[model samples]
Target: MELSELPSFDFESIIKSAVKKKDTHPVMDLPVDYEEFNLTSEFDRDSITAFVKSGGWAVGGYLEKRGVMYSAPRYADGRNIHMGIDIWAKAGEPVYAVLDGVVAYSTFQNDEGNYGGTLILKHMVEGQEIYALYGHLSKESLELHINGEKKKKGEVVGWLGEESENGNWPTHLHYQLCIEDPGEPDMPGVVAKENLIPARERYPDPRILLGDIY
Candidate 1:
């Protein structure tokens, strides 16, 4: 069956209600089209920086790493845990959108230990207002993003930054998906394992819609 003919579901309602009441500087990745990814090793090249900076790299297959769902960023309420999949890329390299959308929120939320600069875009994917997040960027990028700016897929929004500028980590984009509303522009992306349930439910699995990481 054609993608256009796929049966519909109630996911749209869930997305609409969430958008109506969401959070600060909120806007809210894939790689430059999500060509491929390898998690077994550290991603150093622009093709892989996030993993080298953080603990894990991009998953090579379609699904998230085993046990990641229960993991902090991925676990339901685990704040420190993983929420969205990581895209390992190099610093200073231009970051591009996997699809088109409106810039919901962007800023230099320097309060946290990390996430020096962040950008959030709201895309109407499959008729749902899916929020995409980009964090750990060069200071210059934050100063340039204007709210409500419309960007097309594959457009270069900003470049990755050095470890010092990118929250003291190797240059890479810390991308994530959110539905619960961050409450603020720079709200915590990851949390301790204790808060996993709400985080999971509020931030439903983006993998459900993003197929084939590699």
Candidate 2:
């Protein structure tokens, strides 16, 4: 859908409502010793995995402008602005729901640089609908639940996919949020420089829900 066609909302209000209804269930059982990884440049999978191992775990912040990592021929459109927070951990780490929601869509996208096995959940915060997209999940995750299934906050949803399953990236969870329903299991987790403004509007900073992990 065109960026112009996407619905707008009082993002602040939605965030406030979500905060008021905060569920402490972590999306992942991250370690207290976790550090943040700077993935703003191209790096091989081994490097990221090594970093994660060194830190016990690690996270990649949102909106980190990158280049070679997102360069073509995989990302042919020059989408280098990361719109999600990546939680780096060992492969097969279980992921949980951060909020109570209904499964909206699920699919396995096998293309390179894609989300691979993905799931999008629809949430209602004070009557305003929002979406959370879980990307780079294991192929087995697709069989864990069906579309329209209900998930409670903190419930086990899936696991981190292996490199062969998770679009050839290091083991991690690409967690993103949508102020408006993306209408699909997948949404653009990265965008070109020119689209940053609209992309920010559609995809708000997940930190509001994730809290100060940076």
- Per-residue lDDT of model 1, residues 1-214, tens digit only: 3223333435635654554443212111333443345432343444344444443333332122222323222234433345555555556666766567778888775432467678887777446566777888788887667888898866777777676676655455666766534545654455454555555555554443343344
lDDT of 2 at 206: 78
Q: Highest lDDT: which candidate?
A: 2
By summed lDDT, which 10 consecutive residues of candidate 1 come out lowest? Answer: 22-31
**True-vs-predicted CA distance for residue 68, candidate 2, Å:** 1.7
Worst 10 residues of 2 by lDDT: 1-10
Shift of residue 207 alpha carbon in model 1, Å: 3.5
Which regions of candidate 2 fall more than 4 Å away from where they truly are?
1-10, 53-55
Native-to-model Cα distance after best TM-score fit, residue 75 in candidate 2, in Å: 1.0
